[model samples]
Target chain A: MGSYNWNWPILLKEPYFGWIVSGFGKTILIAVFAWAIAFPLGSAIGIARTADNRALRLAGTVYVDIFRNIPLLVQMFLWYFVVPELLPADWGRWVKRDMPYPQFITAVACLGLYTASRVGEQVRSGIEAIPRGQRDAGLAMGLTPTQVYRYVLIPVAYRTIIPPLTSDFLGVFKNSSLALTIGVLELTSQARQIEEYTFAAFEAFTVATVLYCLVTGLVIVIMRIVESRTRIAGTIAVGAQ
Target chain B: MFGSFDFGILLANAPFLWNGMLLTLQLTALAVTGGLLLGVVLAVLRLSPIKPLAWVVEAYVNFLRSMPLILVIFWFYTLVPKLIGRPVSGFYSVLIAFVMFEAAYYSEIIRAGISSVRRGQISAAMALGLTKMQSMRYVILPQAVRNMVPVLLTQSIVMLQDTSLVYVVGLRDFLTSADIVASRDNRPTELYMFVAIVFLVICFSASRLANQLRRRYSL
Candidate 1:
């Protein structure tokens, strides 16, 4: 076996350092953009899952099942490689050739869509976890079903589910690394690129690992603050024994 | 709208995809087994009276949990071969990565499962003159495992979906097999759609089963 060299300085050097920064930026971009799509869409689907109409609930369930069951990597490939081809010819050409940051767009769409299924489940459970009496009380008070959800259900559900939503938010950041598979140049792929260029796999991955931990750690800390701040004051704490 | 798709391509590549599916199952089984075995150890250590041991285990789980699995896979794919002074096969490398990475998750689950058991059970076991190990083995673990069954099943489903990342190391898991055939036949849409359907069926059914088990066990 050849002797392995430990080179730490390479990561701090010019192009590689720039790559890491840009890659980190892209990772944040993907997560934030994906959340922008996932939050409202997921809340809507979650609401639909509990809707009185059978068709609406079924549609929501179907959406969640299809999106959640398939692996995100496969979805990434389909969105990037297959979706364009299925469109009209000119549209296909435009998506394939002329769309700006096509890979980034595809990655955001895939991650957003996939995460929505999970968030929708969380939202549905949050809504379901409310006492049955609350809904009945809302209806008795002359509120429409939609108004009941908007006024009595969604607000409480969203607050109660903040902890789980925090995890999902972190998941979006972690899953955004898959964007690299579609050529999105996210942090993980940039690590792979650095390894390819320098053959210092250990150094490259070490830096990447540190950066990931830092981001996730920061997210956790911030979320803890959010959890405390947004916590309902009067209700019994969830998961209290 | 999907009139242009040729289902024949999927039919022709059925055997290849089946083999890929088998590999996916094989990897998932190995990783889950290894992960759980190691996870049990880690969880036990984490909850042990030894503070340093617990701290080390806690750090290991936390740091690993915070990172992208693809990076971990890449790390082990390179690191394992160097550490062993031999070129490890991609399958073994990936297996190592997955077992290590998944152990963190499973340990958390196992830790929760263990904690979910009432403290009275352990005290009662000791009062019955059972050794600590015997109490853990015969009393606590049995109860914990029962509570953990549903969650373990759900994690297994996630692991199955995660097996697709083996494509990074050029292992021909189910999705990768579809990718190969898609590129070869120039039928990306058909093959990927087929891939999605297969995963959908397996995962959806398994998740439903898990939910049923969860409901049953909760009662």
Candidate 2:
């Protein structure tokens, strides 16, 4: 067997180090893009699930089911490769030409849709967790259904669902690495690239893993703070010490 | 335009897709079994009498839970073989990675189920001349396992979907095979629609199965 020289210090020099730093930036960018899109869409789908109209509820339910069940990678491929082809020729050409960031867009859409399903479920459960009398009281006061939901149901439900929503957000952040398969140069993808260049697999991935843990840990801390502040007084206690 | 939906292309690729489907099922089954075994061990560790052991298990679960499964998959694919001075097969690496990652998650679910078992039951078991292990094995485990049916099923379904990430390591799972066919045929839309439909069917069935289990067990 041939012995190969492995130099960790040299690997961290100049351009190599810059790439790792930029990779971190790209990861944060991907996570932010996905979360920003997913949160509101999830909230809407969640609200729709609780509507009076059965058809709307059904539509929302089906949407959530389809997205939640399929893998994000499959969905990203569909959005990037498949959906573009289905468009009209000029539009398809435009998408192929103008959309340099198809991978990023697809990542955001996939994460958003996937996270929305889980968030929708959380939202539904949160709303259900709130006592029915609150809605009834809102109705007695002559508030419209939208007003009741907007002013009463949603705020309370949002508060209750914050913890789960935080976890979902963290999941989105982690899952954004799937974008690499589609050519987005996020953290994992960049790490893979570095490993290919230098064959320093451990150093590359260990750094990536630590960065992921840092981001997710920050999310957990923020969620705990939110959970503490918004907790309904004496209603439910947090189980984790 | 790809000249409308082509049932012909789909029919032509059905056999290949079937092969891919079989592989997907194989990977999912293997990974789910591995996950369950690892999950059970970690669950026990998390509930161990020793505080340090519990803390270590908690950290493992937290780290695995936080890290993306794709990263874990990549880590196994790249680092494990390199670290061990051998090249591991992509399929086995993926399986191992899934097991390690999902175990942490499922362990938490199992731990939750175990903890949810009333304290009285354990005390009663102890009072009946049973050792701690015996009490856990007989009284706590049965109820915990029963209560965990729904969550365990859901986790399995999620794992099934997550198997698609194996494509990153160049594994020819369902999604990868479909990608190849799509790229080769230059009909990404039709091919992906087919892929999506396949995923939808599998996931929906799994979820339905989970619901059935939940109903049957009344967990």
Candidate 3:
């Protein structure tokens, strides 16, 4: 029988603490950068899907469907392996050899683009839920279609979808762990490394599990605040996904 | 760059990929069925009037939902054999992990579906001398399941995508098959492209079907 030599202080000590804390930092960094890209990219695609032109709508739909349906892990590998090779030879060489932190770049891009598809879906649905008359009124008031969306459609849609958006934000945070599959040294990977080093498989993951719950729990609280503060009066009933 | 795109290599590996695809589909089916049933129970318990029990359910869902799927996969891959006193296969470990992990997401969908049913309907069922469980079974659940099917299926798409994670435990699902072939043949681009397309086609069609079902069933 194996002896149960549990040391809670292992997490408080040198290499383990640094590994986990930095891993947490990386997870947040990847999620934040990804969301930064996803938000604008998604809004553009969302607007495109809601456009009157068929080609634009179709383009948006195709982008969302292709990216959303493909698994993130597959897409991650595609970005890491295939996308580089498909670039021009010199550029491909740079990505493969010379570029700094290519894995991180690929992880961020894959997660950002993948998440944009989902955010676009939510954005489109949120915009569609707005009354058609609002668009008409903005047009009647001498607003361009773009201006109408920018001024009239977007603000309300964003407010309405805050709850769903919160969940998606949480989704991105969780998904960032997938980056470790491509050698990003994010939280999950660091936990695995710790387990390998200390031979305390359970302890390493226990710390990680607690850290995840804490971060997610904090995000929920902050998002709840945002949801309430920005909520339109009597419009969006609070809901869970 | 794509001008010289090679289908010949990918076509030659179709049978190899198919084996993995089948495993992926099998994992999805098993996980979805087990998860959905378990999720329904969790949802009911979450919504039950028993405060302590509801809190316990809430904690379970919250804790699991917060953690990443890969972490859960790792935990189960190592932890299960310890609990059972015998080593289990990668396939069994992954299946059990996926079902438990997916149940959290499915529970929320089911809970939302249940709450979407009008309160008046439940009251009316009770007025007709139906017990709470009986009313939920005969009246509420039928409607909830109908409304929830589309969302459930949408989550199934996510699960199907997630089955690729079983590759980490060396369970040779679709992505892993493509991976094995790619590493062996040094045709990573072609094989990955092929696998990605297969995933895209299946998930896209399934999503369309879900939308159709949503329109047909949603009240």
Candidate 4:
């Protein structure tokens, strides 16, 4: 233990620094792209959960339950390894050999769908928290149920749920590290790579820890700004301490 | 793919998969128990009036919470041996990491639960001439535990699912066992599908139970 040397400089050197930067970029890329899928799909599922149609609600519940219950790592494996195999023989061959950035694509799809379930739950809660009077008022105004959601419920629910959504967004960043399992070579994977290449596990991980904190810190600040700016005047203040 | 699906290999590998599932369950149970115990202590320390001690505990929890659990596992997997001046088993390293990592999350939940107990309960206990420690034990914690149970169950479900991450360090957790058999048997779809179904059933039912408890207690 005493014989272990601390080598911080290697992280700043040529290839290692490049690895860190590229890994950082890939992580952000995966998280943001995944969010693109999650937000819309989750919002739809959330809306369905709150709707009057029994079948729609049941379907939404089924989707949320299945996606939320499975571990993200297993989901990642299934998407990467099993999905391609399940395709038609020629298509499977193409996915296995011809697809561009297969690992990255699988990572984004897996993470996107998984986080969608969580976002759906948050959206459901947000909508449920709205007063009964709000819905009744929309009905009295002769707005159809769909119109009521489109014009009234969704806008308010989305705003009210921003805080929880922000956390889920952060979850995506943290969860993006799992992409390393399927060889997407994101930030955590790169840190492990550096550790393997040089036995300076402490130094490599320390740098990774700092980088993760910086990204999360930046996200928190940005979300705080968004929260303040979009805060509706009379809505229930969540997390009001 | 469905027509060619191999059921026989899965039947042959059932014992192996079951053993892996057992290991996964064992890890989840140990981590949840250990994490909750450590978390309660952290929550108490953070809530205590000792400014320096509270500050230190807060920093530790926040730092751990900010990073990914996988990174924590890897760091401790590498760091513990150095600390002990000898190599340790992968299971021990992962156990240490899960307990510590989960403590941060569980502590926050416990802290919230404790805070949700009304301030008047403490005052009432004080008016009854009980000591602060006595008040906490007799008055506050019982109510806090009631509120905390449902959320704690939910968190444990999360940790149970997270136990699959043990595969990263090559420990043969449930998912890893399925993975091994899938690759060996060339039946990734069947094996992985079975793993997903197993996780879905356990976690979904657990969550439903959590929801029922929440409703029962809220009344």
For each candidate, the alpha-carbon lDDT, in order, equals 0.90, 0.84, 0.90, 0.91
The DockQ figures for the candidates are 0.77, 0.69, 0.78, 0.80
Candidate 2 global TM-score: 0.94
- How does the DockQ of candidate 4 come out? 0.80
The numbered model that scores best in DockQ is: 4
Residue-wise C-alpha lDDT for candidate 3, range B102-143, written one tens digit per residue: 999999999989989999999999999999889989999999
Question: What's the true lDDT of residue A53 in model 1?
Answer: 99
Q: Which ten residues in a row have the lowest lDDT in candidate 3 chain A?
A: A1-10
Encode model 1's per-residue lDDT on B130-171: one tens digit a residue: 999999899998889888889888888999999999888889
Docking class of 1: medium
- Give one digit per residue, the lDDT tens place, for model 3 in A1-241: 1545676788878899999999989999999999999989988899899999999999999999999899999999999989988899999898899888888988999999998988999899989989999999999999999899999999999988887887788899999999988899999999999988887788889999998899899988987888788888876565554
The true-versus-predicted C-alpha distance at residue A170 of model 4, in Å, is 0.8
Q: What value does the lDDT take at residue B44 in candidate 4?
A: 91
Query: In candidate 4, what are the lDDT values of residues A9-94, reduced to their tens digit?
Result: 99999799999999999999999999999999999899899999999999999999999899999899899988887889999999
Candidate numbers, best DockQ first, in rank order:
4, 3, 1, 2
Q: Give model 2's DockQ, 2 decimals.
A: 0.69
- Candidate 3: give the clashing pairs: none
TM-score of chain A of 3: 0.95
- Give the 10-residue window scoring lowest on summed lDDT in candidate 4 chain B: B210-219
List where candidate 1 sits over 4 angstroms from the true fold.
A235-241, B120-139
